[model samples]
Target: MMLYKLRLTFVLIAIGLNIGVQAQDFIPILKKRAYLNNSYQKLLKVTDTLKIAFIGGSITETNKGWRDQTMQWFASKYPNAKFKQINAGLSGTGSSLGVYRIDEHVLNHQPDLVFIEFAVNDYKASKHHILEAFEGMVLKIKKANPKTDICFIYTFSEAMLESYEKGFYPNSIIAMEEIASHYNISSVNFAPDIIQRIKNKTLAVIGPKQHPDSTYFSSDGVHPYENTGHLYYTQTLTKALDKLLNKGKRFNSKKDIYYSAQLEKAKMTHLETQMFNGIKAEIPPPKFSSLIQNIFALNQVEDLLQIQFKGDRIGFMDIIGPSSGTLKIKIDDQEPQYITRFDRFCSYERLHWFIIDGLAPDIQHSISISLAPNRIDKARILGKATDTEDYKKETWRVGKILMVDK
Candidate 1:
């Protein structure tokens, strides 16, 4: 009887070891030698309260997602410490918008620790833009509170696994790592770990069964399901945190200055309305689904929202739904540029940025935007869809204007 019990225990231990080995086989422990020791020290010796903020896309935006899980872990680990967790995550937004709104959405609350996640969403942006936005966020946070600690976390989707399998880092991750290296900060990457599991055939990118019901890490290869994908992300983050705590090393700050002209201008710029077409039009919210808060609705073409502001860079965010239209944008005597928001791949309310950069930093600039006439039929078709609802007739809507001045 005793032998039988020992045998069962050994089997369980073996199974656990095998699973761990497979899960960690290809995972890169950390992007650099530096870890979040600054934040760890703060956590270990908190007198009053520690406020943490997470900035990311939909994955980190889920209510009980990894962000919440990490918060719970903190609560459990430090029972006496008061913790205030702020979720500044907006779905379908990359770091470009993040840099523009960090002051309003995150920095105002004054967070001691900030976790940034845009690996999945920033893929489409140019490397220069990604670097500028990422560096801007880090610099702004650290400048506001020198003691604040920031960490970059890379989240994966079905599209990114192939690159990891080939032992190459994705472009987004590479761009962020450059900033992380320059800032002497640390980054957590899960691509190798996930690829290991996929290679071992223990996990499927997409669930086999469909229609009635299905089991998958992600429903559509991008956003993870509420349970499975989020759990994996939480597990990865917690493990990294545990290691960071145990390392007992402090970050080496070189006191390097990271600066961008656009970022500096953005610090004191506002996008106020200088003029309108003198019409009050109630814009309906874009039909594209999203988890982001504060979306302005526009439903009429005749309703023109004209604004004039003094800034070097000026832009606005709008939805590109199935029935999305085009906008005629003119910046300070420049030729009017027509921007079409519709495409065959249009499904979600994507956040789009239209800005003219490199203008006289301190000069006052005026811009105008209005819906282009006869735009519905001219939209390029990229895919096929079926719907009883007239999703093709919805008007374009802008959320808010972003401006940056010297």
Candidate 2:
């Protein structure tokens, strides 16, 4: 009996050791490639503030998520280096929207190290739009400052697992990776890393903590719980950055031309309503509002507002809500185009880019917008209680205009 008991204990010990070894073998590690080599070196030699920009969807926008943790890691890593974290994340926006707003949201900050994460959000955007927006963003960053270092951080959502299980990266990842490779930009894909751990039976996909479940990592399978999700991101980023700090620049002189087409003509310029008319005219500011600011509200169908700027392409920086309405836009001697800001799934105050591109560059262009005679009483998904109270009768509101120059 004693011998049998001892043998059973020995077998259990062996099984545990084997499982531990398997888990260790599957431990996820990021690539050792260097990113923003010149900018990083400059940070090491200077005492000025090192601004690190985090731009992406909700994951990146969460102030407490990986953004802050990564910044903290940098602070501890470089005790003497001054670091400032710039949060340029807009929730529910993909790279296409990002390209249009990057100038106003991110480039204005002038960061030294920028992390662009849009793998999950870009899933809804077309491949063509993704390429143009992604490439446009990278090129714009380079154009803003050649020494600015950029890294494309690929994050995976729970829905993305199906494709990974089929031995394929998601479409968004595939599209963004192409651009990252062309630019020789450093990229880190954490999907496979997490997937590997799950397959190894060490990580849980869903369950209560008392049992075997890791649903706590991500509550809805897309947006991660700040603590768990952010930890995973920071771990991957800090590990890769630590490795990169010990390495030399990947390129002797980083090549500037990643793609042949510069996409420079796709730039956007923001013009406020004050540019069209003063504070007391055809457009009036909201009596009481919180979501939008410095906007010109129009209620009547005949209320016309015109803006003239020196650029080829122009777009409106406006938000949509339950009270939003349709508008007719005319650009530089062209027929009027009709646009609606209302949708079946519209409720939140989010920036919408209504743009008309492909105009003659270096020429003056005029744009006129007015409320369409027809109104849309959208079916409220969240009920009428959430409608914008002050602008219940307002049809169209112009927040700002964006013009692009070649």
The candidate scoring highest on lDDT is 1
Per-model lDDT: 0.66, 0.65
Question: Quick one: RMSD of model 2?
Answer: 9.6
TM-score of each: 0.80, 0.77
Candidate 1 local lDDT, residue 179:
85
lDDT of 1 at 120: 92
What are the runs in model 1 whose C-alpha is more than 4 Å off?
A: 1-27, 32-38, 45-47, 208-215, 246-254, 258-261, 264-274, 279-302, 319-323, 343-352, 358-362, 377-394
lDDT of 2: 0.65
Q: Taking the tens digit of each residue's C-alpha lDDT, what string does model 1 give over 1-406?
A: 0011111010112321122211222224454446565566667676867889999988888798889988998899888778999888877789988887787778889887899999999876777888888988887787677777788999888777655554455678768877887777767765545555666666667773343443467767777655667777777777767666543444544455554535633542323333455543333354333323344444566656666566557777665666677777777898888877776656655556555677665767676677777645523364454352545565665666666643
- Candidate 2: pairs in clash: 269-402
Give a tens-digit lDDT track for model 2, residues 78-152.
888888778877677777667766776677888888889998888766666678778888878877887777888
